[model samples]
Target: MCTTADESGMTTLPEISLAKLTADETRGEERQRLETACQEYGFFCLVEHSIPKKQIGQAIEASRQFFALPQSIKERYSHAAQNVYPAVARGYGPLHGEILHPEAHTDPKELFGLGIENEGDRRPFAGATRFPDEASAPGFARSLLALQATVLNKVVPQLGTALADMIGMEQGWFQRHFSPPTLMQRVIRYPARGGKCGKHTDGGFFTLVLQEELPTRSLQVWFRGRWMPVPSLPDSLVVNLGDMFQALSDERFKSTPHQVAHSGLSDRISLPFFIYPDIYTRLTSRQGRHSFGVAEMMLRNMESVAAGNGAGRAREL
Candidate 1:
């Protein structure tokens, strides 16, 4: 029963075990808890999931090794520079590469993004991703891609099934639309600068953040009309619904606003796997009156956020 708090206090995000929901014995109760959390908080911590701890550690190390390379070496994969495939949103983004809020300062983070690498794909944001030479960091691309496959194949579908069941849709209804999903895995490094990613909601269905334990809290969520810190939990993935999920649920769920700020003690590294439905798949509300393609909604939301037009408010999907 984790519900919204008044303006004076922070709302606690419930931590649920994904393993329990996948088991028939506990599925009923676990599903109920998930439904409640989605309706109330729109965010939670996932534990007991299928991803191996060793793989998680390896992914973190691979990201660290990649980032530690000299600027000249890392620049070879720069998204802004090497993106011959203009539709592809893959490759590297330098520090302060993006300004999340036009009025606010640039985000104090560097990003390396890799998405479903389908050759000859024409859809927007779909195509092969650029990778650095093995000389820069051996096996970095292979290891990270392996980790991404595990999440896309094993983790995201189960969560989608749970959501469909909660909404009274047939099991696997939502999962079917995500076949050959447009997925992106981003490794982000935040420096100790005072700049923070301004308040904004994600554009897709949901995001799974694999973050290393930090000395102090760096993630914050907008709840109860105030910003509340989300403490770093070990061996857990922070899960949050995005704008498309909010729309697909017909506003029954929320797409909570969140941001990252400087922790001051140490640089932070986070891996976020963004799960998007197929670009052409049209998501319809339960009532059937509203329907929109995932790509269309995502583009509109991104444009709105970039323009600082109602950036803090959830847009209609």
Candidate 2:
């Protein structure tokens, strides 16, 4: 802990093998590595997670084409028209629409987001899933849907079970709460004007991200009072713990602050899957001193967050 970090910052974040983490013979050692990663840094790269790399690329491309559409066509699907839950989470958030930083400023980016779809309940967080029509961008909706289906089937359950075990919870705990889970997926595109997105902790339990194929050290995390760069690798995705998990685990895990600090070069694209407990799920800290519902925390955050004018996601609760 005393050594000064060199230029190759955060180069040693453990890359866990998901296959081994699930196998009976190797689960023990691999679980320890995962536990440490969550508790110490709250972020790491996930490999052998069974997600299709090619599909992720296609989704990114689809997002690129979608964003590249004429401004008029893009605005046609704005969150305002859809009447998003907080008035700015789903459908479309144009450039500089979100405020992820506490200082109340807009991010230099544009995004399209969708929440849980097809559940029996069509409530905001539970079921109100929406996507652009096929006419918006050819195969855009299908590509993202296919990608989400893969993550939901492959990574979410496995990772959730691993975390439940790490915190000493009984079997099926995650499954119980995550039955028809509350999820939000986003495709964001930032232009060549290099700048930093707001620094804030995620509001969900965790996130799985597929970064652009090229090695752009844009994603950074705050650790030990310094920002360290997350390495980008081929055929693997990035994972980070989030606020709900931190509270649910009684802080055994951390919800570290992170940001997208990109250098103006080429357009940057990212696919992030935000996982949460059922919106109605209430969580209590490990020691039982803190308690709150997932919806409550989210609404609290939305009250003063970033829709350009600062009131939807500017800061975390």
Candidate 3:
């Protein structure tokens, strides 16, 4: 039995593992915390989440190794050409000047990217991954790839189901539309500067961030009209839904807006895995629960967002 506040500002997340409940009895109770927190805070820390601490460390180490490479070496895989997978995935993207937050003063940061879908001649959305030669990161690539495979195959599906249930949809409602899909990862290295990441909301369903390490300045989430600091949990990862989740859940879930401030002391490193639905599939509510087709509704929403210039570039590999 946990209690939370509403939009009037008096809410708290239930001290419970909302993800572990499988019975209707517990689900009824869990819904109170989820609905209230989502409506009011738009973000909640997930404790007891099973993401491995060791894997997180490996991912961080891998990012460090890659970013530490000379600019020329890192640029070998840049996102220059388009294959179903490009050899240089945007090739070690630029400083955080234009992209991360388009119209804001962002401290320069370097980023590496990869998309699960449309990579080389492999299967389209099938389990195909293209990493730089192991020689690039030596002993690091295998561990990092293992972690990625685990996260994409195991954690993401569970998170999606939890999200579906949290927003009043039947469990597994979203899992079907996301296979062989476009899952992207961005490994960001935040340099020490007083500048901050501009304000923005994620463009898709949910983002799971494993903070490999953080500078003194932590990432913050915008909830209920205020920026609240989210300090890293010892062994926990951060999870947040995005605009697409908000849309598909019919406003039942809040796709919280968030940003990171520039750190002046130590450099920051964060690995964000962006999980999205297949481009061709639609995301609809449960049968007998909603009126519109999920995909059509989402497409309509996308059109509106694009018309208003709200949608950012699609995360295609």
Best by TM-score: 2
Best by lDDT: 2
RMSD (CA, angstroms), candidate 2: 3.2
Per-residue lDDT tens digits of candidate 2, residues 54-134?
A: 898889999999999998988888887664465566788888777777573778888988866665554555545456678
Error of 2 at 246 (Å): 1.1
Candidate 3 or 2, higher lDDT: 2
lDDT of 3 by residue, 1-317 (tens): 12233446544433335355434667666656656656766666555556678877877887778888887776665555324332323236656423334445434677776655333435332333445778777645576666778788767776677667776666556666776445667777877665355566776788887774452536767655666666665666677777777777766666777778755476677878777777556556543333344335335444533233333232210
Rate residue 135 of model 3 by lDDT: 79
Work out the TM-score per prediction: 0.90, 0.91, 0.76
lDDT of 2: 0.78
Candidate 3: residue 110 lDDT (0-100): 78
Q: State the displacement of the C-alpha of residue 265, model 3, in Å, after optimal TM-score superposition.
A: 2.1
lDDT of 1 by residue, 1-317 (tens): 22234357656788888899999999999999998888777889898888988898888888888988899988878876544344226788878766565555567788888887787776766777779877778767887888988998888888877877776666678768888777867888887655367677787778899888775677887776677778777768889987777777777788888888876666778899888898888888787755888777766654665455534253321
Q: Poorest 10 consecutive residues of model 3 by lDDT?
A: 308-317
Off by over 4 Å in 1: 1-11, 81-88, 193-195, 302-317
Q: The CA-based lDDT of model 3 is what?
A: 0.60
> How do these models rank on lDDT, best leading?
2, 1, 3
